[model samples]
Target chain A: MLFLKRYLPLVICGFTGVVFGIQYYVPHKASEDLLTFINDWMIIIFGFSMILALASLFHVHYQKIRRRQSGWGFSLIVFIAIIVTVIIGIISQGETVDEKGLTSFGWIYTNMLVPLSGTMFSILAFFIASAAFRAFRARTLDAFLLLFAAIIIMFGRVPAGEYLWSKIWGAEFPLQMGDITEWIMGVLNMAARRGILLGVALGAIATSLKIIFGIERAYLGEKE
Target chain B: MRSIFHLLIFLLIEGQAFSQELTPPKELKAFDAPYDSGNVLYLTWKGMPYDSEKVDYIVYISESEEGPFFEIGRFKSNTHFKADKNWPAWAWKRTTEYHYFEISSFIKEGKEIPLENGKTYFLKLLVTDGIKQVKSNVVSAFPKGNLFNLLKLNNLIYMIIFSVIILWFIARAKKRELFLRKIPALEAIEEAIGRSTEMGRPIYFLTGRLGMSSVSTIASTIILGEVAKKVATYGTEIKVPHTDPIVMSVCQEITKQAYISAGRPDAYREDSNFFITEDQFSYTAAVDGLMVREKPAACFYMGYYYAESLLLSEVGASIGAIQIAGTDAEHQLPFFVTTCDYTLIGEELYAASAYLSKNPVLMGTLRGQDVGKGFLMGAVFIGTGLATLGTITGAMQIVSFVLDWFKGF
Candidate 1:
């Protein structure tokens, strides 16, 4: 039982990982067909997994309410939101959940979900300001450089920066703030970003190799 | 007698008009398209009438060299130079085969010509406007797919070479000592946990919004196992609020295992690792609220993060928590760097897990990756030098060959 429970999964992981990794290099029709078939199965399996997660969520909230935890009211609200949303979703969706159908589910998503998400996202503006204020302190060489770059970027991204530059330099200053900003972002930032991305790619490949060989099993719960 | 003389004069005028002739197209050729399925036959012709108004071209295809040809397409002169574009979809074959093509013209007469003569095959041009028409020579091509594309052969070679190198390094690294540079963010994890323990406050871990399938999340989970073990040993309470359900369940097991391994199984609480919400901002809001209310001494943000990175890190900073963070998300690095005490940049996040755990296999793989990267760096430097020399000397065959080889991949 223990072997079937643990070793079996690892074996399956190794087999699938190797097969899919090799599939990228193959251009044969049979290889492509098999890849497509497995991808479909994955989607179906993911659907089932989501259901399991949903069950776990409900159970967590149910326990919270039952035990009268500190935020039990919020737990009750979560239950209400989920149940109502699911019921409306199934009822309004005739045969499919595609937005092409004019349904109350779409209405709920557009009106309730979108606005709520947007409101929450808009709050980031204030958080950015707060973070910027703290980050812009010039205590060290690195800090001073960061502060300078941040100031230049902030000024260059808007029309006001260009307008101020033109007014101060009589329009012949040779470099506009916007142009400087564009150069900094396009040349300096892009170059650094690409270098980091290359390293990240190599790291990802190594990690994938480790997983395929079953060397990285910490994610599988524990090291044996 | 007078009517007969007028008819004779009209006949002579019509004969004179019919004497005009069209020049036949020159240097017509046909061949199979390279690097594709055996379906396409390419045909090219020169000497299309640049004026185009005097003559129009029609293309015909035939199965055999002899006999019946059918009109595949027709166009105004100069409309198209290549006849390959008109390969009929119905004529597409799985096997490499041959087809014959003919280029002909239809000269317009005073009367409207139907353009399609009922006959299936004939190499004849019609004269219109009382003019004479001409036909071009027929062209034949045998199209077939090659067994292998030389264009993509380099890609296969590179893949094999890289695989061998990585495997060789891994084998070597397993038995020998490999030097690894220090990552400050990973080193601070222990100090952060100890601080939390001394402060008598809970340590909070925020796994990013991504699920377990992402590489960053996988890396983060490995690091989490180490952190949880340390927390268990220190007897500090730890809270993990997850945005993904599977991550939450996996984390719960990891925390439990850590506690068990620490010989403090009684101290482990299942409720400590629980799902908050999957919605991005909602999860961020919940974490922010937790940071304000619970005020954890140490907060670790380790995984793939996006817009919510700044929000979470700033809140942690505001709460005076000892914040340690790591991710492969480059854009979010600036935020984490500014707000968190220590930030792992790019690949450092990946290296952190293996570095902290010191698992022989994981460390071996990391060393192998370094070897691969070193090889790539050497290749880049040498290739750049060779290319510069090649350009200066105007002897670019070697550089071109090298570039083409790399481009294939």
Candidate 2:
């Protein structure tokens, strides 16, 4: 019984896997209908999962409030926000995404969310500048090459480099540099991208094979 | 009996005369030419000339100079007959062999005529020019190859290059001497964990938005296990927030295992690995909140990420955490490059755990990747040089030919 309980899901998954796999090669109408039914079931399962997650969130925060924890006030604030949003969303006949009905959600998202998110994201600009200053020190040959590449890329992407060089060398120099930049990006970057893509492809294939063959079952969690 | 016999003999004689005197339409050669592809020939001929009164023309084709011909295709009672294009659509399959074609005209009350294949038959065209019949001289031509079969040879070069790279990697991996550089994002793991331990603040490790089985996520989980072990040994707090339930469960197990391995199983907290909402923005918001509230000393973001990368990293930075991020998303790399203290640019994310763990299997794979990269670099150099030299010297024709040959499907 214990073995059955533990392996039951795996067995069902395996059966479904084989069915779906073979369905690809089966041109019959019945096989197509079966695959469609399975796809619909998957969507329903995803919906249920979402509901369960929301419930978990509610339970956790509600318990925090009931216990009068130190963060109970914040929990209350969060609970009220969620409740009001849900209520407005439901009461508006679920058409809250429309222009007029979206006022409340839109206000909250724009005022409270977008700015905070955008501000957080903008910090990356400053961080990049600092990191570049420190990390691009050319400590080694590889570092120097990386720095050179970065400089060329930055200059090539912007128009100022061309303008400055065009004035210095009359005209042809900037054009030559532009050509070099294009060559670097087209050849060097494409090569690197291809290499990375190939590795990713192989890794994905190996991992997928492991999953399909049941060699990797870490996602099922602990045996018990 | 004599009257019946007289009627029958009269009818029989009339039918025989009609059969013998009726002829196909005249001037069957004056039709318009059909559309022509390079390999297929389509010819449209004028209707037979004999059908100016009450008959129509039927076209026929044959493969020899002799008497048998049959109808291959048909058209309406118009001034044209188009040859089928599919008959000779390829140059190699087409022959200069001569074939015969003819047309026949017939009226409703006249005798029915039969057409055969492979023999030239005289054809007469009949038309309702509203009054009488017109005849045209017969014209003929042999059917031959059309122009549609020119081979598209350009894709072969790409196939050759792709195969060479793949083969080279496999061969090098088998030999086992491919060198891979250490990724710095992975190198900072110990330092980040040690710093968090010393500071008495919990360490926060997020495996970005990828699910449990993604390569970057797997790499993150492995590194998380290692980091969790160190934290457990030092009796430091560790929090792992996951966007995927499956990943949360896996991380919990890995964390527990790590604690046990470190001989500090008692310090393991199962709840430390918790699932946040899977919505990209919501997860980022939740994680940002966690960072603000917990103010972890060390923050690690390792997996696949998108726009939320900057948001999470920025929050970590604001919390003054020693932030280390690794991902394979090229688009997100710029954000990570700016915000994270250490960022792994593409394949480096996969290389990180392998580099740190020094697992033989993973190392072998990394070696394979390096071999692939080297082969790609060599190809790039050769291709670029050829293209550039070709362009400079106006030798683009040769370059194009070579490229076409090498690039294969």
Candidate with best TM-score: 1
Cα deviation of B64 in candidate 1 (Å)?
13
Instruction: State model 2's lDDT.
Output: 0.61
Worst lDDT 10-window in candidate 2 chain B: B32-41
Q: Pick the candidate with the highest DockQ.
A: 1
Q: Which ten residues in a row have the lowest lDDT in candidate 2 chain A?
A: A215-224
Off by over 4 Å in 1: A94-103, A170-174, B1-155, B379-400, B407-409
Please, what are the lDDT tens digits per residue for candidate 2 over residues A1-224? 75674577567656775666555444344565687897797677656656645655666567769898656787688779878877866665555266555556666666776786676567557756665775588998977987899899887777897776677877855365577688899999876766666666544433333345443343333211
TM-score of 1: 0.77
| Alpha carbon lDDT at B181, candidate 2 | 72
Question: Taking the tens digit of each residue's C-alpha lDDT, what string does model 2 give over B60-179?
Answer: 443343424444334334323332212322211222221123233222234444322222333322323334434334344432222221332232233335434444544455566456
- Model 2 docking tier (incorrect/acceptable/medium/high): incorrect
Candidate-wise lDDT, in order: 0.74, 0.61
**Candidate 1, residues A7-118: lDDT per residue as tens digits?**
8878988998888776665544456678889879867776776775777667778997999977788789989988898898879853334647647777787788888779
Clash tally, candidates in order: 5, 46
